[model samples]
Target: MIRHATTADFEFIFELYMHPAINPWLLYEPMDAVHFQPIFQELLERKVLYVFEVAEIPVGMCKLVPEEHRSAHVLYVGGIGIHPSFAGNGYGVQLMEAIKLFADAEGYRRLELSVAAINEKAMHVYEKAGFLKEGILRKYTYQKAEDRYLDEVMMSCLL
Candidate 1:
């Protein structure tokens, strides 16, 4: 099941956010309870975060942020991640489809997102969901462990 996230799911979401396997691709540092509490509270209030549940267990999440600086007709997918245990089970595609449908219903003209250049799996998933490679942002994000920069590939889909 896919549904808007609630404050009650914060613990599970935080666990996933701090998962070691996900650290490398994350743009922000791992969250402690102090950091995540307020964010999860805001997410519940804003209703912009969605989670995928398998038999009532959270498996993945997608967060969307409206493009306020530009036109309201565009929505940006801020983040999408699935638990490593669920990676090969097609949950990512299901989550993408849900996002696309939600965007269409909300009258968004386009959906935009960025993926780390080295994340081939996520790029493939986005491409399969009808997002096209738009461009690249050089040194877009900082890689903490490597102490270097990483490129981000911009992608978009016309809803």
Candidate 2:
């Protein structure tokens, strides 16, 4: 199940965001809980972060930010990650399917997201979920820690 995140989900959300297996592709740099608290709070306040669960146990996370006015029918998906422990269990596609349902229910006509171009694994999952690659933003994401820039591929699934 997917639902709005609560303060109680801090730990799971943190682990997923900071986990070595998941963090490189995410937006935030590695940081201690003390540093991430404010960001988490902001997401909560915006009501964009969501917790993905299995039998009430938080197992993944996602962010859905709706566009406004001219693009109101679009929902941008970000911060997507499945707990490393649950990786390879086919949950990624399940999570993607659920996201689609949620977007449809919310009346979004398009679901969009970007993935690091080199992240073939994630791209495969997104493709399985019906997202089609639109284009690549060359050297779009700079990883300060690694002093490297990664291309980001834009993708969208029409609901």
Candidate 3:
């Protein structure tokens, strides 16, 4: 099942976000309950966060932000993660489909997301989801803890 995420799902979401398989790709350090409480609350109020479950077990999450307040008519998809145990099980594709359905129903004309250059698995998933590589932003993100830079690949799909 794919559905809007509620506050109760935060703990599970945090666990998935912190899973070892996800660390290298995620932008932020693993979050704790306290760290996610406020953000989850805000997402719930804004109707932007989504959770995916299979057999009643939470498996992944995706967050989308509209660009009305920004420079484009695009919707930004951020922070998509599947638990390590659920990776490669097609949950990522299902999450992408759900996002597409929501975008189409909301009259959105484009969807955009950024992926780290080294995250090949996620890049492949995005491509399979119909998103095309737009360009790469050199040293787009800095991992302060690691004292290194990461290139970001920009991708978008026209609906």
Q: Using TM-score as the measure, which candidate wins?
A: 2
Score every model by TM-score. 0.89, 0.99, 0.88
lDDT by residue (58-113, candidate 3, tens digit) is 88888888887554568999879988777778888777877898888878889999
Cα-based lDDT for every prediction: 0.84, 0.96, 0.82
Q: Which stretches in model 1 have alpha-carbon errors above 4 Å?
A: 54-56
Instruction: State which candidate, 1 or 2, has the greater lDDT.
Output: 2
Lowest summed lDDT across 10 adjacent residues in model 3 is found at 23-32
Q: What local lDDT does model 1 show for residue 134?
A: 95
For model 2 the local lDDT of residue 110 reads 98
What is the full ranking by lDDT, best candidate first? 2, 1, 3
lDDT by residue (1-159, candidate 1, tens digit) is 568888778877787777888767765577688887887787779888888887887889878878775678999896588999888988888788888988888888899999999999999999989999999999999977688888999999998
Clash pairs detected, candidate 2: none
Candidate 2 residues 19-119, lDDT tens each?
A: 99999999999999999999999999999999999888888999999999999999999999999889999889989999999999999999999999999
Against the true structure, candidate 1 reaches a TM-score of: 0.89
